[model samples]
Target: MDVPRGFSAIESSAEIVNMPLSMCCDWQGFTYTMSGWHYLCEMLREYKLKPKNNYRKSILKKYYDKYQPYSTFECFLCEEEYDPLRHSTPWVPLPWESAFRIRLSDNQHFGPNSNTFIRKEFVRTISLYHRLESQGYQPQENKDGYIRGHFLKKGDDYRFKVSGGQHRMAALGVLGQKDLHVKIQPDWKRVIDIQHIHHWEHVKNGTYSEEAARKIFNFYFETTGIEKAKKYGLL
Candidate 1:
């Protein structure tokens, strides 16, 4: 299948839009803790480094133990383990993973078992949370700088998916900001009426079948988008 690219690379063509925090979600369309905002908020509130580390470890261990067996590979760049089974719920790999596939694959240092890797990731998340909280959200002067995302529309309803600046979004969420200004590409209002946006997370988390996911993907994305999904054995 040749899935046509839905997101644009040119940043100048993008526009900023204000959306409610309740309608915002991570790249995979998950909100709150599943979207990782809760964890980021917890780290921001905890002053003691040891407690933060413990908290991070516990969270990672819980998810890792449950999902690691299904993960085909883990990417430290985003501090996520990629399980084709879960990610390919809709028969397409997450856009960021597809874009950074080479870098992610080459940068797999010490798998999930290494404490050093865990500690480094924990520290990185904490640093990002603190930096955004203290310095405030500064939109980078690049395509990847802003809180970039896209709107998934289903009839009259819409949801914003944060494709970039996830940590910054989480920080802002903790700071009690209800309205978010998100940078979106020219093709931002892509219709995805195959299903409700809230059901997307359920699809990614393995609650939905691949058959259903394929139906959704075929409805929303073009044939060209599945090349990466095929490469990841998602087909």
Candidate 2:
């Protein structure tokens, strides 16, 4: 687990209450244990961390998988598409009402990376937004004060890739309702980073084939210099 770059522990707690401590701990542990900084350097050496690579990784495969068949749908939006055979009433750790992340690019060319599990979880989030809106959740006026300006990570530019709560945002956009408040409690980035790293590691290690790994690795690492070969010591 890597201590997410931008925010400090104190700032994290004060700014976002729901920030996942487990994620923070995991990131800190991984970087400390694994000597992960060298991976960043290697990526720079290979030129695999370019923005073009990241764009390809994040966008292309997502479009492909969206067209592929999925097995289940645990949330509202996906409830219509996929089925929950067993655990008919199983619940996820995160609740429906919690303030979560949502990326601006969704299902489009530069949608969230498929390697990130948060993308799948977010399918249900759209329905949550619909539910809230249907129940007469009013829009806010001073939207700038809302959670729109939150950073993805300390060092990373651009907003954090939203793991959930996208539908609410879209509804607000469609309604031209800037008054809605988007709250961000940042904890998942550590976990997300872990997942991102693990997925590529699996790919590079031959657990997942080269084809599947290529798009995924290139997408996230392109801009960040997060290469599988360097990060996992394959090089």
Candidate 3:
């Protein structure tokens, strides 16, 4: 029995080895690679899965260019690729750029400016200008030109004493100009009488209720007017 069993009597065995390796991470959700860290994106060559379409591919390319590993915790506003970041502002109308003649007269006038409708009008004008330009019309003049004035800080918390561009300035703020740098046009001083007209009517004629004026003033002093109507509370 021993002689016959020789090789047949012995047997070999293999054991499965389990290492402490981490899960795999994906590159732009294309190809996935093994790594200890999450939110991983690999080199472009290593990109595995093709985008669903050309749009997706384009988006991926844009994301690849500006994306940094540490930016995961940052706000989208901090990204240069953000939509708002596309336009540099206090956007001046260029010579070649076609736009409508936006004049201060075409807009409503107010002192220390009205919080209402100013933003709406500014946005409307800009939007129209963009549309017209797209259609190949050039604006010969900007009637609704703005004037610039720096804040002459009065005291603690520094109240701004209406230096210039009261209406257009309010409009710009409402329109959200973080990079606005255009100087305020100098002619705003000539329009002071017209400016006071709106205020006189509203304040004296009571076009705006006393309660409304108080609320509007309080809202402006408090928030950036982004959430004014919603955040406003009556005393």
Give the residue spans of candidate 2 off by over 4 A: 1-156, 177-187, 190-206, 209-214, 217-235
Spell out the clash pairs found in candidate 1. 2-223, 2-224, 3-222, 3-223, 3-224, 3-225
- What is the C-alpha lDDT profile of model 2 across 1-235, one tens digit per residue? 2333333432443332222211211110111012222221222222223433442243234332432312212211123322245323223122111232323333331223354443343334334445655764433443432332232222332223333333443333333342333334444322233234334444445333444333332333333212322332343
List per-prediction Cα lDDT, in the order shown: 0.45, 0.31, 0.25
lDDT tens digits, residue span 63-121, model 1? 32322322222211122334455555322343312222322221222123455555555
Which scores greater on lDDT, model 1 or model 2?
1
TM-score of each: 0.53, 0.27, 0.22
Question: What TM-score does structure 1 among the candidates reach?
Answer: 0.53
* Model 3 lowest lDDT segment of ten: 19-28
lDDT tens digits by residue: candidate 3, 145-168: 323321111122311223333333
- Report the backbone clash tally of model 2: 16
The alpha-carbon deviation from the true structure for residue 199 of candidate 2, after best TM-score superposition, in angstroms, is 8.6
Pairwise lDDT winner, candidates 2 and 3: 2
Superior by TM-score: candidate 2 or candidate 3:
2
